[model samples]
Target chain A: MIQKKICMLGGFAVGKTSLVRRFVSNVFSDQYQTTIGVTVEKKCVTVASQEIMMVLWDLYGEDEFQHVRDLYLRGSSGYIVVMDGTRKDTLQTALALQQTAANTVGPVPFVSIINKADMRSEWEIDEHVIEQLRDRSWTVLFGSAKLGQGVDELFLNLATQMVQRPPLSNTHP
Target chain B: MSSDSGRSLPNSPTSEGFTSREEDWTQLRTLLLAPEQTQLDELRERLDHRMVHSQEVSQVLPEAIAIRGVGDQQLSNALTPYVENGFIAAVRKSPRAIVDAIAPIMGPAIRQAIARALQSMTQSLNRSLDESLSIRGLRWRLEAWRTGRPFAEVVLVHTLRYRVEQVFLIHRETGLLLHHVATDAAVVQDQHVISGMLTAIQDYVRDSFGASPDQTLDQVEVGEWTVWIEQGSQAYLACVIRGTPPASLREDVHDALAHIHALHANALADFAGDATPFKATQPYLESCLLAHYERPPKQGALKGWILIGLIVLGVVWWGWMAYQAQSRWSHLLDRLREEPGIVITQARSMWGDYHIEGLRDPLAKAPTALVIEAGLNPATVKMEWAPFYALDAPLVLARAQSILRPPESVQFHIEGGILVATGSASPDWAREAKRLAVLVPGISQYRDDGLVTASISALLDRINRTVIHFPSGSSTVEPSERVALDTVAAILRELDQLVSQSSQRVHLEVLGWTDATGPPARNLQLSQERAEAVVAVLREKRLDKAATVVLGSVRPLDQGGSNQESANQRVATLRATLTAQGQDSQTADP
Candidate 1:
């Protein structure tokens, strides 16, 4: 079995922690408590008849904590940059975080997850943005942690990719 | 020595009493100089201990648990025994009892220490009162004071006493006790001496006023009275006095008492020491002071006018700021509107070659300009100009050229400034050719006759547009032409509204013709089909559908000299006829 270390990163209160919780434990918390540091959880997924372990790291979501994000991304095979669908600035922050992670992890696969998908009426994330990111060869997933929608599929897809291509060397087992 | 003066020898007890009185007077003098010193030192020590203990407690305990202080009830309970035995005289006591009993028991040194302590305590209390009694604090204190018992009960009582005496002094010439409280139920033994003092005081006031002794007499009562001298009715001098004097000689006594009170009050005003004349009345004086200092009621209309003025000024200021902001925003928008091309160019630079559809040179010439113009860069092109149909094909073709390259083998035929081009190219190459055709200047029309041999799917789009048309007289279309016809219909509707309204009835005529390559009958049929195609669109536009008759002119019969001329001859024409109804007819072409 192959295991992939995947980190979720974004700005403060953007629901990065909730996304991981929705994926791993199938739970959502509405209360927004600032994450002190980083939280790690694991889930096993089966894709195309192959077993893959996804070790998801839910890092603290604050611009101030961005300096330490690379350390979390160091052993990761991929990342999911989360942003609130209602806030455009969070998307920009997520993009910056994604770039930082890519630089640190040496071209690790990444996806942009526009969370809070239930709020489509209030969504600031436009289809043009998705097309642009997709053109750049990064997957874009719109999801809602509260509804538990698209959370599992996002992880499973990333896990399959991880199994097919291992992370850059020097990653811990 | 007494035998020559013929007075009886005084008893030992009487002699002792006289000597004791003399000793008492001496002690009083000493006590007055150092009154309450010991008590004051003890109080200072206790205060220091309390402060230190409170600091320690505050350090040890949580903020919520720190104790405030002993309550008044508890303090009063502790002092009850001393007070009962006459050790601690109530504040109501006369100056005599205060001097005699208190001085002997506490001693001059202790008395002095207590007085100093009390004085320092009073000063500290006053400082704290000044510090704590800010307007807000005083408001809160007053509210609490009114709602419940006074929070500072002891201080309030002391203040009351001082204020009452001050009031009494203000009315001193009236010979009335404005305020007083009895220290003991029983009268003092020196009644005669007090009476004699009253007589002397009355005589002094009568002399001062130059009034007869009997005429100056006024109301008299025990311990206080009022006297008046006849001057003017309002100008008469009234005196109020306090302390006991004889009833039989009360009229004379009232005059004296009035003189004494005025002298005492004046003396008090002149004295630089801390003691206030207000303190003479004891417990009721603080209330009097509060009443004396109470603020007068504010005028209603003045306050209301002030409030209105402030509100009006605020509204004007806000309105001015908003107006300025709105003007600034509009100015920025106006600047943006003036440079449409620049804005589009900037957007293109920011986003790169993405959804910018018609990225083309605007100087291009081509026919079916509408479809070609649709291909122009949506990002780089702003919707600033009212689009002319003649420019559409040229603009679109230019855009297509930017996206795709044409094949090398493509050729062109130019006749009378009209260029005809055809080639077998890839779908991409055909798109590029269309784009290139649009870039050519003065070319009015185009036909997509070139074949895309490699992809049937690519040619399907062009086939679809050519086959679509509107239903009839409604400006709406058949389901097949729904999307494209809707866009055209919207433009036509806008044009219809934009044209002059006073030109009477507008008549639209549809004519159709066909190519000369076919047999006569077939060419005639093809021409009819072309004619119907245009008539159908006119009918759908709701533009005089009855007037929109299809005129079929077969190709060879109507052919011009060259293929370009012949193609022009094969064109469909939709003419608008304007009838003036009651006036002369005026025709306009759109």
Candidate 2:
């Protein structure tokens, strides 16, 4: 059995907390309460016939709280950069946070999540955009926090990937 | 003595031997009449003399004498007859045996009687005169004092009737008055008399003096009298007549004194040194000198300063207002220049819509053509064009005419992908030209031939090549990919007219694809996420979102080889489909 820590990061009010709540608790809350500092949740699953425990660190979604992001990512096996699917500006903030995590915690597996998929009518994300980002080594996922759809599978698959290629320094004791 | 004369004298014991009874009666009558007549005659003589000598004294003397004679008229009149008689007759007639008999005894008695009468008369006359004169002088002096001329060298004296008193003398160098008292008489021994006379003299001098150097005098009081002596440039003399001497006699004394003093002053004027008593008092006289010689003029400089201040203030205020107006106008001009195209478009659209009803029938004669045939008349359709910037006049006029009527004739031309439609419709050719313009995309430059057509599909294909992609829900560029996205937004904006003509809403499909490295569920999610990211970038460019749709696929088996696999698997495809609301099918596809 192996354990992995993962971090969620994005701009304030960009669905970072909602996505984390959807992935960890398997439930969605319409009312958005801003994350205060870091909320850690654990979920166990079977990947490649091995039991894996994921310590998901949902961080406060404000650029001002970036000082504390490295601390949360200290033992993270992977990271998920979450952003509002309809906001083009928030996507930049998401990528910035991802870059920060990468530089501070060394190279780690990470995926970009475009949440709030139920708003597809107003969804502005397209294929050429995903291909363009793919060149940067970021995997993309879409989910709707309000409908509790595609929420669990996004994290479950990330845990499996982490188990297959775990970080060389798993310092968490 | 005659019995009648003896009987005339009283039978008193003291008078019985003093003189015979007849002598006593005659002497008594003579004594009474003579003394009275003599005193009265003296007063009359003084009064007459004063009248001839000084008009001022004469004016008041008659009234004074008349009042003094109130009690002694009979005695005073009887003196007339006796004076008319010979003095020799009285001496020869045994009137106490002439000088030896009457000289010693009668002399003392006559002297005493005369003294008493004169003293009483003077006291009575002067008391009344002094009171009236003092009150009148005080009133006049107070008036002068209020006018800032509280002091002077000479004053008109009521006591001397109309004559003026000289009370001040000037020091040589300073030209100031040195002494302030009358100068004609000697200094009085009695303080009370001197003080009263001094006060009257001062009041008179201060009221009459004109503050001129020529009228300056030195005055002093002497025993119930005032004396004024000319000094400096002055040659006039003044005297105050007092005592119970006849008014005529007093006038004579005053005349004599004034004449003598005038002579003396004139004679000594040249001999008097700068340090003479008169010259030492010039400082005191300076203040009373005419104001013209002492004060300087200041009005010219004061007026110039005020005028300069007013001019400066006026200029400052005018400049401030002009600057404010210029700034306000500049702001308005900036707003107008920033959105010129939008303002022009809105105006043209409104004008076209306003006359739409009249241009519905193509067979009807064009309103503009009819108006032109009727001698260049303007069309009835009202048009208003408000351009944010100054617009070309020919363009606006042509546009207005085309809106009013469509042409019937047709011509054709083609350049690049632009289709120029020009023709006259019965109503107007504007609607057909506008329709053709809307259909042509990338018509950057064009010339109208009146009829032409071009393929719009080729334009959309060109636009597609410029379209770029982003990571799903991310603003981060995948290095070297931003150029494509920028081009796409620019081309879309450029071809906005063609796009708008097909349908206001263009349904955009963003197909997100994922590499084979992820599981089915995750891959599907990733694909959808990628599709959303592309859509977001489009919306940021102000693309119509209601016209947008996203489709994603997770074909893990479709992965390519090596570096190409990541690029091919993660690629997103954009497709725009034009559709109208409530329509089951779309017309245009790209």
- lDDT score of residue B565 within candidate 1: 51
Model 1 chain B: weakest 10-residue lDDT segment is B162-171
State the displacement of the C-alpha of residue B547, model 2, in Å, after optimal TM-score superposition: 5.1
How well docked is model 2, in DockQ terms?
0.00
| Residue B299 displacement (Å), model 2 | 17
What's the DockQ of model 1?
A: 0.00
User: In candidate 1, what are the lDDT values of residues A1-173, reduced to their tens digit?
Assistant: 43455677888888888888887778888888776556656676876555555656667785753444344465456888888989888877877887788777767677778888889899887988878888988888888999998888778767666544523443233
Model 1 alpha-carbon miss at residue A168, Å: 4.0
- Cα lDDT for residue A16, model 1? 80
lDDT of 2 by residue, A8-102 (tens): 77888878777776666767677879766566565667766656656566767856534433544554567888878787777778777887888
Q: Runs in model 1 with CA error above 4 Å? A: A64-68, A171-173, B1-590
* B478-538 per-residue lDDT for model 1 (tens digits): 5664455444343333223322334343333444455455466875665566657655665
Worst ten-residue run, lDDT, model 2 chain B?
B287-296
